[model samples]
Target: MSFCTRFAPSPTGPLHLGHAYSALVAHDMARAQGGSFLLRFEDTDLERSKPEYVRQALDDLAWLGITWDAPPLMQSAHLGIYNQSVEGLTSRGLTYPCRCSRKDIAAALAAPQEGAPHAVYPQTCKTRSMVERGAGDAVRLHMDRALNQASAGLGFIEDGPLHCGVHPIDPAALLDEIGDIVIGRKDIQTAAYFLASAIDDMRQNITHVVRGVDLFEFTQVQILLLDLLGHTPPRYHHHDLIRDDDGKRLAKRDDARAISVYRKDGASPDDIRLMIGL
Candidate 1:
């Protein structure tokens, strides 16, 4: 396939320097490969995503001289597609309704057994039968079952600073570590970040995925899902993140590091490139 990559951002807050760094890196990668660059909005969080944020983000990208090949793909407009994916999983008995709240999960983790260092879902709803399941409950993928159904030793290639090679997916480690991750949010009636983004990447024909290193681990889960769904995984390029003076990753809440704030203070786009070491 021809090289195709995307810079997808949630319109829940202002565009921070971290966002700019990721977008610029993806844009540069596409341009260098003489390929297509695409823009997308992960605006599924209806409560937080606003029209103003979307408008400002578009302006910021334009000001940075990052041009896309096509119109932006909005996540909200494609809810039906994600719903269909969830339905497919549900029909195949690979997903189960989860009624466990955050507090319920925390309490379960707090009463954990010895030798368990981290807190993961205790699979409280794992045994619930489909007939007993109803709406208004979050849906979780049966990771073990899904992985078993997929081809053996599933994994993806990483082209990032931390891990730059092919890492095979270990079903045992995933089951003991990540557990059954929630993929369908009952409140939103849409798939979670992992499911929605993975499906969108394949649907959009993304051959190369570029993002920050923070999402590297989640890529494993996505690759598993893509494989189960019978789609080819893309080459992933995870870039370094922009951080604050305290060495913490920059977030949307950090208005001081927001791209709009920098632009308002008369910082040129070149200055941004220099700051992020682009």
Candidate 2:
């Protein structure tokens, strides 16, 4: 099969060095393999996503000599598709309504024996019937069933420059660790990151996923979703994240480290590649 990969970045903030490294790595990987490179805007977070940031992200990638096969895929335009997927999953009894708020989950986790990644759902509403799911309910995947589905002989081969190799997932570990992640927020009709991302990758025919190591744990969750949705799982390459001098992973709030700031400082695209050790 032909190799395909994508560089998907949210337009919530200006493209930073971390974004550059990710895009370049994905672009280079596809080019090296004589494959296709796709650019997708992960702007599912409608509240914070801005058109200006989207434009700047495209411009920044262009300046770095990255090119996509077609016009970039924008998530905002595909809300209906995500909604349909959500409906399908819900119909399959693979998702449930979550009434617990973040604060509620946090409070539950604070009690002894709660856990480290604090605030995991205590399944407060897990046993609630579908008829009870109301307008205020958020949709969450049924991790137990999803894991059984994904664990049935699932694996993939990853290809990329920064960190490349085959990575296999244990379905049991996925269920135990990732437990019933939210797919759609009741407050917003748009799909969550995990759902939108998995659907987008399959819909776009992406054969490889190149992203930061910070999201490595979430891969199993995505894998489970793909399996549940009957979509093929793609190869994955989780690269090292760019960090500040203090070793903290870069965030959108770090304006000082934004790529626009680096450009203004006369830093070349090559300079960025070297800075990130690409």
Candidate 3:
């Protein structure tokens, strides 16, 4: 199959050096394989996503010689598709309406339970009646129920620089750790990152997924959802992240590390590559 990958960035903040490293890695991988590269704007956070950030991202990518096959896909305009997927999961009894607020979840997780390594949402609203799914209630996947329904082992091939191997998906760990993750946040009127990105990958026929190592754990959740949705999961490449002098991962909020700022400082695209160790 032709190699296909994407560099998806949320426009909530400026594109920083970390973003540059990821985009260039994905871009170079696609070029090496003579495949397709896609640019996708993960602007699900409507309130924070800015048009100027989108433009800046495009300009930076162009300066680095990162091109795409077509116009960018914006998640904001594709709400219906994500909503339809949410409805499908709900109809199968794999999802439940969550009425608990952040504070409620935090309180529930304040005390760790025995045999559970980490605290997760107590599933306070998992058993709630679907009829109670109101205008403001978020939709969460019943992880246990979904896994049982799947009735098979889930795994993904990793070809990245770090931890490269076929990683098995542990449903038990997901249930205990990431229990009942929200799929559709009614409050925001947008699907969660995991749900939307997974759906979009399948929709775009992505053959390879290239992203930061920080997202390695979340890949299992996406693989679970993809299998439940009957879509073939793609091969993954979780590259090393760019960090600062203190060995902290770069954040989009760090304007000093923003690609635009570097461009303004007479930093060429080649300089960016060198700085990022490309």
Output the lDDT of residue 49, model 2.
96
Q: Compare candidates 1 and 3 on lDDT and give the better one.
A: 3
Candidate 3 wrongly placed segments (more than 4 Å): 111-119
The global C-alpha lDDT for each of the candidates, from Candidate 1 onward, is 0.88, 0.83, 0.89
Off by over 4 Å in 2: 113-119, 160-167
lDDT of 1 at 10: 93
Determine the backbone clash count of candidate 1: 0
TM-scores across all candidates?
0.95, 0.92, 0.95
Q: Write model 1 residue lDDT over 90-207, tens digit each, in one string.
A: 7878888888988888777777563354666888899986566667788899987898788876889887777899988877777887879888887646668889999999988999
Which is the better candidate, 2 or 3, if ranked by lDDT?
3
List of clashing residue pairs for candidate 2? none
Which numbered prediction scores highest in lDDT against the true structure? 3
Cα displacement (Å) at residue 210, model 1: 0.5
The segments of candidate 1 whose C-alpha lies over 4 angstroms from its true place after superposition are 112-117
